[model samples]
Target: MTDYFWDFDGTLYDTYRGMVKSFVIACTESGFKVESDQVYKSMRRTSLHQTFAIFLKNVDFKKKQRIVTRYETVEKSEQTNDRPFKGAAEVCKWVIEQNGRNFLVTHRNKSALNMLKRDQFTSLFTGCVTSENNFPRKPNPASLNFLCDQYQVDKDNSFMVGDRALDIEAAHKAGIKGILFDPDDIIFVETVPDKRIKSLLKIIV
Candidate 1:
């Protein structure tokens, strides 16, 4: 009965394509000519902020604000991609069938809930920790800690599964093990996660 905390973006949902599109659009609107492939490549290894900082180095603070604002607005739009990754829903159902529990911890706000509802995945989770909850972002452990307390989940018997280093770091900060979902085997780090899985189905109980 391991309790689980899941990252919603690239781990569960295939949101990378949409993210890249939105980012490119935002930067373009802000007068920057951002290449899609370059953005995608940087996003694979870095956070959005770092990616922006690298490409938009010459952009003023006010212009950067406009770009970020535009990105957020576009990300929250209805056409944004919200499809779940292969076997993601099955993994959640597996947790439930094994008498374990699962919850979402994502930077997204209401958009996360909306996507879950749209995809009929809402009932799969015990609860969610989103930006709207006002918790600090990943690697801070505040939101993960809150969820652990709320669900009475034992840190030793819990896992946080996500696609990025921040997710693993956050789980570590919360005193729980982290599972890195690396479908592409892109992460060649010496060590970051307690476990690694190439596919969702590999996450056995």
Candidate 2:
């Protein structure tokens, strides 16, 4: 059975809107007005940290840190409002019904688990690796390798499903397939993934 390694934000869940909103609010509060579309594009192409670095390049480290802290606080406070994408739960359940397993690898801290629990998705995963684990962030493959070793995952049959290029790169680095879930068709990656689909339900084994 194939194992599915899932990304949390923008993959299984439609969290980018909330993330962008929070980021915009934080930046505006810090006296930096950013366009939401630009922020979304940057975030989708790179990461939150990179996005901050890109926008706050001229800001002092102290101000940047404050903005980041504020963003995190806003995001955490609105975590309950975030929801999984349509058919996300169905696709995950479909994998289990096919005797496959689901795993979560996210940059988010323990709050990711809290969201899963809140959404009643905690039991859907066989394993998870989050920021709490302190593993190097994705595209590094450290977290993926840890899960592969820990659960004895079959690299050939398994796939890492994520919305960003880093996820595909990380899966490849870990010796597994990558599935790019690009609903908006805005993401551009130099390397092609094993499969690219717009819907979570298209991830059939």
Candidate 3:
């Protein structure tokens, strides 16, 4: 069985609304005004810090973190439109049935895992590693190494699936095949799985 590493936001749960809400709250409360479209566009692939600065410019990192932390709580308990993507449950179940371990990796603060716990996603993953209460976030290999050491996941047989270039880069760096999430977003993965698909269902199932 191939061990799987997955991303949380956008990969499984549809937290775009919550993300938008949290970002708006964080930026505005910190100091600046953020237009909805700008925020929306930033959501496509922006890093959390960059996203924060786009709205909460000039804010100290520590204070900015507070804004983001508070917003995370709101997104957790105040879930309005949260949902697992189409066939997410099925894909997860299939992985389990195939005797594969599924790890949820996200740049989201670990506090957001509380939302997953409240939302019942904790039951779905073998392990959920978030950027908050853990090692450096994705695009970085520290977290990935932590996961490998913790789970004894086979790097050769293992794989990563994410919508970001960093995900593939990390997978390659960690010696795992990088299976990109967007079939339409072709990239230069010339030596690995180098495969891209639109849906996790297509790859995992």
Candidate 4:
């Protein structure tokens, strides 16, 4: 069976909206006004640690902590808006029909994961990997390898669907196919059996 590893925040669901509110709350609490789209991109695609580090460097640690705390709370409250993309639910069902396992990967904390569970997507996902789950953040192979082991999926047959470069990096390191999804970079590179996609609807049969 094939294993489908998915990113939750920006890929499977439209979480940028919620993240905007959370980022603003966090940055504002830290006395810094951040650009919403930039912060969302950093959090979802590249390095969240780097983004936070930049913000923290400009402010006192106590205030930074308060900002982080506020973000955690704000994000949890904003979970209601994190709805799945159109036809994504059907895609999940289609993958299952093809004898595939669906894994939800995220850097979100436990509270955020719990919010998804309460929001009705829990049944759609067979397993979830979160920051609270103790795996190193994305661009790291540790978490994806864990999912492979749990689902008994071979790396070569597995595919990760995410809206970030880290997803491709992690998939490549783990010997799985990294199918990147980014509107700006639709140019699919043939090396390592990885390809970049412009839209979820374009995912081929």
* TM per prediction: 0.91, 0.98, 0.78, 0.86
Which residue runs does candidate 1 get wrong by more than 4 Å?
78-80, 188-191
Better of 1 and 2 by lDDT: 2
Q: What is the lDDT of residue 101 in candidate 4?
A: 75
Model 3 Cα lDDT, one tens digit per residue, 1-205 = 8788887666677676677777777667766678766775566455555676766677788887798788777766646567777766787778788888788778876655776676676777777677665667667777777788898998988877776667777788788877777534543444345677788788753
Highest lDDT: give the candidate number: 2
Residues 75-103, candidate 2: write the lDDT tens digits: 98778799999988999999999899999
lDDT of 2 at 119: 94
- lDDT (Cα, 0-100) at 67 in candidate 1: 87
lDDT for 144 (candidate 3): 73
The C-alpha RMSD in Å for every predicted model, in order, reads: 1.9, 0.9, 3.5, 2.8
Give Cα-based local distance difference scores for all models: 0.85, 0.93, 0.72, 0.74
Per-residue lDDT for 67-137 in model 1, tens only? 88999888777334569988989999989988989999988777888889999999999989888898887
Candidate 4 lDDT over residue span 145-179, tens digit each: 89888877877788998877777778888888887
Q: How are the candidates ranked when ordered by TM-score, highest leading?
A: 2, 1, 4, 3
Worst 10 residues of 4 by lDDT: 184-193
Clashing pairs in 3: none
What shift in Å separates residue 61 of candidate 2 from its native position after superposition? 0.7
Worst 10 residues of 1 by lDDT: 73-82
- Show how many residue pairs clash in every candidate, following the order shown: 0, 0, 0, 0
Instruction: Quote the lDDT for 6 in model 4.
Output: 87
